[model samples]
Target: AHGVARPAAPLSTFLVGFAAARNGGTAADIEQACATATGLALEWAKTHPTETR
Candidate 1:
């Protein structure tokens, strides 16, 4: 969230944990959730480079 929604960083983390739990609370599930969220964030940052707040 460096150049994006900094305030949303914590919310994003919570969502990732929730998703991982729903998918089966395992290390692999957590890893997958983090990867998926990271990919989406990167894509969003790339496409919406000027987004703020």
Candidate 2:
């Protein structure tokens, strides 16, 4: 398995996406990451921006 655990892969991917969004990465990258994490399309996230703390 090349020393990689399949179960952990999704977590890693989710982190990358969250980091990208938090860091204000390009709209496309942020959207893709959010979509992957929520299973909802990027368009949905766009309509529901997170409130700033």
Candidate 3:
């Protein structure tokens, strides 16, 4: 982990956006998918607290 950098947004968000675009979804649809992924991440964090470094 010394040289690795985490993405600003999760990989899931990117994947969802890419899939939506490839499937002919509108820009707004992609945006909605990304937003949904972000909300899901936050909910996951709420359920599983991380330890301080």
Candidate 4:
């Protein structure tokens, strides 16, 4: 997991949820998107720390 700041983590998840909704995301879509985003976050954290929380 990216080291997202505790205070901002849930708020940021809303953005991700909105994105999933905008894309007509079903449960599968949400899962896939979340996985992708999480993977990217972990990768970015290795260098630039993309998480706010």
TM-score of each: 0.88, 0.43, 0.59, 0.67
> What are the per-model numbers of colliding residue pairs?
0, 0, 0, 3
Clashing pairs in 1: none
Cα lDDT tens digits for candidate 3, 1-53: 11123564466656887877876799887877778766776787778676557
Over 4 Å off in model 3, which ranges? Answer: 1-10
Off by over 4 Å in 1: 51-53
* lDDT tens digits by residue: candidate 1, 1-53: 68666799889999999999999989999999999999998898788777444
lDDT of 2 by residue, 1-53 (tens): 12344685678676967778777788887876766655543455477665556
Model 4, span 1-53: residue lDDT tens = 22755777787688779878887879977887788778877776789745444
TM-score of 2: 0.43
Q: What is the lDDT of residue 17 in candidate 1?
A: 100
In order, candidate lDDTs are 0.91, 0.63, 0.67, 0.74
RMSD of 2: 13.5
Output the worst ten-in-a-row residue range by lDDT, candidate 4.
44-53
User: In candidate 4, residue 38 scores what lDDT?
Assistant: 85
Candidate 2 lDDT at 40 equals: 40
